[model samples]
Target: MVEVNQFYLKFEANPDRYTLSDLNFCLNHGESLLLLGPSGCGKSTLTYCLNGLYPRELDGEMRGEIVINGKPATEYRPGEISQQVGVVFQDPETQFCMLTVEDEVAFGLENIGVPHEIMEGKINHVLEMVQLLAFKKSAISSLSGGQKQRLALACILALEPSLLILDEPTANLDPIAKKDVIHTIQSIQEKTNCSLIIIEHQLDGWTELTERCLLLNRKGIIFYDGDIRDAIAFKLDELQEQGIWLPKITQYLLKKRLKTEQKLPLTVKEFEEKPFSLFGNEEVNEGNNLPEAGLPYIKASHISWKVGQQPIIQDISLTLYNGEFIAIVGANGSGKTSFSRILAGIQRPTKGSVSIKDRKLGSWKESQLREEVGYVFQNPEHQFIANTVFDEIAFSLRLKMENEAVVKEKVQAVLETCGLLQLQHEHPYALSQGQKRRLSVAAMIVDDQPFLLLDEPTFGQDASSNAELMGLLQGRYESGATIAMITHDMELIHDFATRVIVLHKGRLVADLAPTELWQLPIEKLHKWQLALPIQVQVQNCLKKEGDYAAQSS
Candidate 1:
């Protein structure tokens, strides 16, 4: 149904820098394709070209043919192409055009000239498919990130497109939300029998839905294309070396040097179908030791925040000590991000007070407060203000009128530290997701703030980049900078956070060490939209099957 022949694409500014080169692929009707690659490898670019966004909506050079539904892409009207090919972007906020969930879904149908009499039925059906019918009247501004994502899908599905393209649809969602989105997609496919193309970082989420795999390299060349099982078993090392994520089960089996003549399992059920004794016991990675932090660096007293009578954060009191590595975790809309903002003074609490180093937060000058408490926003673009990367990291230094020599030296040091030295002259928006994440941290830590608040710092990043970024943060923590981060990556919390703070429905729920948090009942964790790490889940399953030795340390 879709075909690309000798395709090559490059943007206008840098004609020599091709985003995609000599790409060729075909997608038959009702087939699902999984596209995997590192950040900035043109996975998103491919989706754009297929959806008729490249060379039309965007300024770019193209050198080959793209055919959809057996018709040349150029023959379709400007907006007509979207009816056959629907795309859900990485950030659902960008896809929204209407105020409410129902309006957003019907907006697309209206534009496509669908009759008003039938739009309601179509909207209701799609929302029901995504299990969001109850939220049909919810305001778009009030929906959680996960809900927004489902609404985005509902909007696209309402169009009854022949093919669906989703670009990291679950990147911003919490654990349970991720499962919900994946299950919804599976259900849609089973009922509608539509073609699907997914560009994702989490391989485990797509394993069941994936039939074929397409691997791209740094230069956008298709290095491997084959059955999903073959790709996982034969191309694992090469893919990992190129920064593509592999399933946790695959990683574990490879670590144990176990050989399986049978098909490689993608799900836990498949793994467990074999003899339970075939799996080896692996210890869970206990997190780093808690630092002997000194007196309180930040103290929140009965803090509460609300928006138009809706309490986002309740009366919460806590003390964050200097040099402690802390992680705040909870479901979407549970107020984790709101609480972080309150501590950073980005949001004022509706009630109660906050102090830093024994001084009231309100007493400090704006300039001093900014320097003492650095905040990295959840969306990196929200905090980016400069055009070029070098200028961005050096913006704070320049505000103080530092000499050019000193400014250059400091900016260069940070660029090298974050592995962005080569892209020093590049535009901030042009960097890859992983590079942008690193740049965000580099910009904030350049001032060496005593207290740092980072929200989902590892989002859209690969394993290597995640480690490098965490190492940089660890160095700063060792130097006495108290760090508070909001994340849903349980692996990160298990391995790095000295303390884990749990929040539920705008209230503080648990404050405990990493091990203590893991020991909580599974149902309790699920209530907060959290989950045990992959290793922990496997260990627990093994224990239940009469393999106590397989229990995690």
Candidate 2:
């Protein structure tokens, strides 16, 4: 389905620098390969090269050749490339050209000149594949982060391309949403016998599904290309040391440094039954007291919201205690954003009330509420209201009109904290996606809000950037700031969330501790389209337990 011969590229601004260098690789029919790398390492750049977006859309300097099917990528029109290779971009909103889900899915087919009769069948099949069949008529704005992503996948699938490429498709989805997207793609791949290439940070989803793995370093060159399992085990320690996402079980085994010639376990099944089973059942340790809690720092009682004539959030009630990092997760149409806006007071709840420290929503003045609740929108670009990074971070500070010296001090502190002080004078747009997210956060954090609401904060972020963001959030949480995050990263939940709230079909289905959420038997979370976190996942636990004490230690 795809071929590359000495494929390398450099940004126009920097000729000596190659975004992708000396890459020779190919993807055969029906094969699946994962392209792994750090943020700004050109994984996305390489993906664009596959469909001629490198030279045509991005307008970057290119070298060598990338052939699709049997032709060069440079020769194919973007439309012609779409017929053979479909890409679901990292940001679901950017890929959307239509206002409604059904319209968006049909848009691609119409462009391909597929007959209406064939289009309907194809759309329905693709929707069913992504488990979004019931949302055929839903508006794009009504969907949750996960739902929007699923819709993106369905659009690509409707095209029935020979090769499918997804960039961080599960970036901010809950466990349920993650599973649905994976299952949908897997089902489509199996039925159609098409090639799948995924550039993802969440490696667990692709472990069992992919046929091969391609690892990219800072230079944007392919360093490892082979069987998926071998690539994982061979680089297991290195990947983990750098906080890179690998298979959960693989990380678990590597953490223990198990004595084995075999590489780390790449899948749950292998970790369960393997040469490293000498220390079986080693993950869970002796009982440790669960942390106690108190009245939530923020409370919403039977909240409901609507936009235009359609209701987005139904009656919903939830509480977040002081110092708890809470994850509000659900599918695209599950109301995560509506709930967030309501909590942040950006959108008033239609039927219920919200309060901070027992103060009713209406009682708190707009400026007062803004001071207390910091809301970060999902679209980072929308957050940049100022020209330079310095002014953007200082906007909120200036609103207070503190002493000039005090404002400078506050802005500098946040810039240093967000790791963007060096780029303080640069245009926000020139910064990378991760840098943009940090800038948005700096805008919010410098104001010192007590309650922070971040919508999919790590969507397009790489591992290092995500860790930095998490660390920044963690500092605020520890310092008595309340955090309520909406994301699809199951690992984020496992690594940081004290509690998780799941919404399904516009209702809060589960509100429980992260540890307990993992023990639930039903697939309600699955129905919403998410998966378990990499660390606390059952497979990782099983792998740990299977090893001997020494190996497990």
Candidate 3:
């Protein structure tokens, strides 16, 4: 369905640098390919080329040739390739052009000049495939992040393209929603027999659907390409070094060096089917040890926020102590972002009060409040203001009129910590999504605020970058900074969160230690749409084996 021969590309902005170098790959009809690579490794850039957006719509120079559906890519007129290939971007909101769900789907069909008589049927069918039929009339603004993503998929599917590309479609979705979206794609591919290309960092959900894998190195060159099982079994170490995320089961098994009777298991079912045994009695700790509470930093009392008549945050009360690493987790649209915003004083509460160190939030001057609290928005671009990456981080320090030497020193240290020292001269907007996310975080952390609130700080990061960023945050926490993170990654919650706060329907439902949160009834966890971390899942699997052995004895 698609073929590339010695493809190379370089953007006009950086004429001397090649974004993609000597890429060669092909996709057969009805085949599914999983594209894995480190963040900012030209994965997304390659996607643009595949969909005929590069060298035409985007300002870039290209070499070699691309053949799609038996025609050279250059031969296709503007917007013609879209009929054969459809791409759903990482940010779903960017692709939306209509107000309502049905309208959005219809707009794509209308652009393609689909018969008006069959447009409604096509829209309804695709919506049904994505399980968004019931939300057909709903406004796009009302849909949750997951629902919006599904709607974006529906829009692309409505055009009936032969090759579908999904770019991190579930990166922002909660556990349950992520599962739902993945299953929906799997079902649609099964029914349509269309070729698929998935670019994502999260590998656990895609392992079952993808037959082959294409791995890319940081230099935009292909590192490995072959059967998914072979890559995981033979090239595990190489993949890890490249910062690619392996399937959860595979990661656990390889990390523990467990003995499996069969080949490396890529999915949970495969792990359960294969007899595996630990090398020794190595018990894994399911949670972190809770630290002693420090002095109060910020306290919220019966705070509530609303938009028009709808409540976004219900009368929630909580106290954040110095040096606390708290995680706010819940389903999409559960008000995690709203509560964090309220705490950061970015948004005023509709009712009740918030105090920082015994002072009401309203009483603090704007500059004082900003110095006291640093907020990182979920969309990194929203927080960026400076032209260059260095200027962005230095903006905070420069505002205080610090000495040039001191500003440069602080900025250099932060850029090094965020792994963005090389891109100091690059425009903040020109960086990749992951790089942008890191820059936003670096800009906020350079000043070392007493309290930090980050909304999905690790949303687009690769495995290595995620660990490094988290380690940086951990260092800050250890230095008496209070950290509250809003996230959908349960694994992150298990690994770093000292306290877990569960929110549901704009209300705080459960606040407990990390260990206690993991001990909740399965039904309760499901009610809140939460999933167990891989460590906990592996622990349960071993516990079940122990129980079976005891029964046999």
Candidate 4:
């Protein structure tokens, strides 16, 4: 279905640098391939090449050979390759052209020249496959992040391409939504027998679907390509070093170091089959020792925000103390971003009040508020204003009339911290999605505001980059900075967040310690679309096993 031989790609902006170097791989019909790599490792670039968006649409130079469906890439007419190889991008919003779900699918079929008489049937069939049949008449703007992604898949599947490429399809989805999209993809693959190339960093739900793995190093060269089990069992260390995310069960095994010769399990069910003791003598401390309550940093009382008649945030009251690490979590469109923006003073509430350190949010001058609070948008590009990466970070410092030498020192320090020093001269827009997210964060953290509010700061990050960014944020929190982040990653909540805030239907439902959040009823967690962290799950499993053994004895 697909083949690449000694492929190399270089962009016009960086003629001397190769984005992807000497990549060689092939995919047989009905085979599913998982492409794993670190941030900015040319994973997305390679996908573009396979989908015929490289030299033809994007400004890049391509060398060597790329064959799709028995034809060389260069020989295909404009937009012809798309009929054979369809790509669903990371952001589904970029792929939609129509307003409603049905119309969106029809647009793709119309472009592909499907018969008008069968277009409705095709649209309904694909929508039903993705479980979006009920939403056929719904507006695209009305769908949740997960629904939009499924609709995107439906559009592509309507084309009936032989090879389907999904680029981080669930990266931005909530836990339940992520599972839904993965299940939808699996169903499609089973029914269509189409080849797949999935590029993603989150591997928990995907490893089970793919048979082979293609690992790429930071230098854009293939590091390992073989059976998925062999790569995880034998090359675990190398995969970790490259910042690839291992399956949750594998991660637990690596950390616990259980004495076993059996192959590493990929899923929790598989792990449960093995006789292993996770807890022996040591008592599990699920709770964290939270910091003492300090002075109130930001206070919101009965905060309610709405768009026209639609309520987004409803009667939410909370206080962010000094030096608190709080994570806001909920389902997509549950008003996490809306509430965060209200706290950051980016958006005014329709009712009630917000105060920062005693002053009402509305009373603070624009300049004073900017100094007191730093807000990072979910979309990194929304916050960028400078041309170069260095200038972006330095923009905040220079506004305060700092000395050039001092500005350079602070900017360089932050650039290095976020792993963007090497790309300082590059335009901010030219950076990869992960790099752009880091740059947005670096620009805000350089100044060290007292209160920092981030919306999905680690959305597009790889393992290593995520660690670096979180580490930097941790340091800031330790230095008396109040932090609140809107995130979908339960692992981040487990590891860093001192407090977890839950929202449902625009209302604050639960606010508690991370451990307490994990202790909620399993059904309630599922209703909220929340998943327990792997660590917590393992500990719970061990507790259940111990209880059963004691009863039997």
Q: Which structure among the candidates has the greatest TM-score?
A: 3
Tens digits of per-residue lDDT for model 1, 391-419:
99999999979998999999998898787
Instruction: Give TM per candidate.
Output: 0.93, 0.87, 0.96, 0.95
Q: List the residue pairs that clash in candidate 1.
A: none
User: Model 2: what TM-score?
Assistant: 0.87
Task: Note the residue pairs that clash in candidate 4.
Answer: none
Off by over 4 Å in 3: 115-118, 128-145, 259-262, 278-281
How many Å off is the CA of 190 in candidate 1? 1.1
Per-residue lDDT, model 4, residue 346, is 89
Q: For residues 477-552, could you state the per-residue lDDT of candidate 3 as single tens digits?
A: 8888999999988888998999999999899999988788888898898778798887887777778888897899
Which pairs clash inside model 3?
A: none
Give the C-alpha lDDT of model 3.
0.88
Cα error of candidate 4 at position 109, Å:
2.3
lDDT (tens digit, per residue) of candidate 4 on 52-104: 88778778688999999888988888889999999998778878998999899
Error of 2 at 77 (Å): 3.6
- Cα distance off (Å), candidate 2, residue 332: 3.9
Ranking by TM-score: 3, 4, 1, 2
Which one wins by lDDT: 1 or 2?
A: 1
- As for lDDT, the candidate ahead, 2 or 4, is 4
